[model samples]
Target: MNLNQLKLFYLAVKHQSLSHAAQELNITQPAVTKGIQRLQEYYEVPLVHKSGKNMELTRAGDNLFKIAKKIFELDKLADDCMAEFHNKGLKHIKMNASESFGAYYLPEFINRFNLKAPKVQVTLEVLSNRQVVENSINLKNDIGFVSFPVKDRKLNSIEIIKDEIVIILNPFHSLAKKKYLKASDLEGQMIIMHEQGSYFQKMIHDLLEANNVCVTMPITFSNNEAIKKAVEGGTGIAPISKKVAAKEIESGKLVALSLLSTPLYRTFYMIYHREKHISGPLKQFINLIQQ
Candidate 1:
């Protein structure tokens, strides 16, 4: 089958108008009609029949339309793939990271990388730790920064930084006066928890359970900013990364206190698919962050 004729038929069926297809294809209406005629003649089946001022596809046309749709879609994808290689200087790096590293640390590294490779474009998304790991494993992102060490053999996980998690409370809260708090200190206190099933939430729960500490957790937030805002509003105290709440702590809107009995610390890991080719822009970003 002639692809040119197939494309004309596809477009005509897609729009349900021969003139509209001709307009888009930048050809005369008769040319489009002839193209469709050739396709129907070659296939020995009526591809389309005319209604009152409209074209309707026959069963064969509908079936061929489905296959042609996929063919053109793949054609466009091939074009895009080739375009990327053609514009070598305009490289793109996609990164998925946990909330803390994405908001606090990745920006500085991206800024530095921009100074070095101005042509490279960096796209960053803040996701949960598990989402980051999943994106890395699926090669959806060129790199990922996650809160916990990934044990997947298909991924290369490198420890990037160690962050301390501390309890943050409104400056006016009674617990704000304490230099340090124990898990027992949190007992009976209203706690603002991370979203259920998050790695951070699990870690906090494990710590509290290990110490036999129970706190009233009535509110949950998926992001640190919301948790900090809630704590500042005196809704409840929250356990979050110190760096994440540094601005609030410095402004006295919140107070950060370490856990005396079991200090919470989490290491952030830089992860990427083991088989992923280290492109120049990706390598530069990894190096800058590692340094």
Candidate 2:
């Protein structure tokens, strides 16, 4: 079977119209029709039929569509896997980061790195700060960006940056008008929370617990972005990293309030296995980060 023709057939079946498939594939409508016709000729069975203005798949076409979906998915997966193979003097760097750094900083940083070394490929995985620390200690990732300092003797931790955690609020929320928020000001207020066991979440809990302040937590999210969106939609207020709220704060889409006289902050650490080799591309990346 011709895979190109099969691709066209899959697209046609997916969109339920040859013309629509043609538009998606950036090919002419007649090309899509011919491609499907070739598939039918090869199988000696009709694959599609017209009813009014819509196209419907035959029994054989339905079966082929299911198989085609799996085929194309695997094909794309293989392409991605092979692209990551280390060869031709190109280096692949594995990075594991906390959600905030991964979402807010890494993309632009990686783009800049790409311009500096086009051949180096960096794969990033966003996880909880604890997971980031564990992966670095276990050598599961080459580098880890996490909020809390690492205490493990097997890993080397370098202080990267300090992130100030701020109280996030909807633009029109009652608290948004406050220049500074106190622990007592937030008592009994609805709040969004982070996932359990998160380092920053622990800090927030500690700060609140220390002041004997309690808030209603209606929902929890695993990442900073989701929590920000929930707060933007007026779900509730949350204490989050200023780095994560920079854009929203600047645009006035969200308000970031200071906590009374107490400043909440978390230090980000760059960690790696002590025994891991630092050379070539990895060394270059470390230099870039340090700079």
Which residue pairs overlap in candidate 2's backbone?
none
Top TM-score model: 1
**Candidate 2 residue-wise lDDT, 186-279, digit = tens:** 8998889889877777888888898998888778997778988999999899998888899999999899998876898878888987766664
User: What are the per-model numbers of colliding residue pairs?
Assistant: 0, 0
lDDT tens digits, residue span 114-171, model 1: 9999999899999888888877765677889998878998789999899899999988
Report lDDT per candidate.
0.86, 0.84
Give all candidate RMSDs, comma-separated: 8.5, 11.7
Alpha-carbon error at 101 in model 1, in Å?
1.7
CA error at residue 192 for candidate 2, angstroms: 0.6
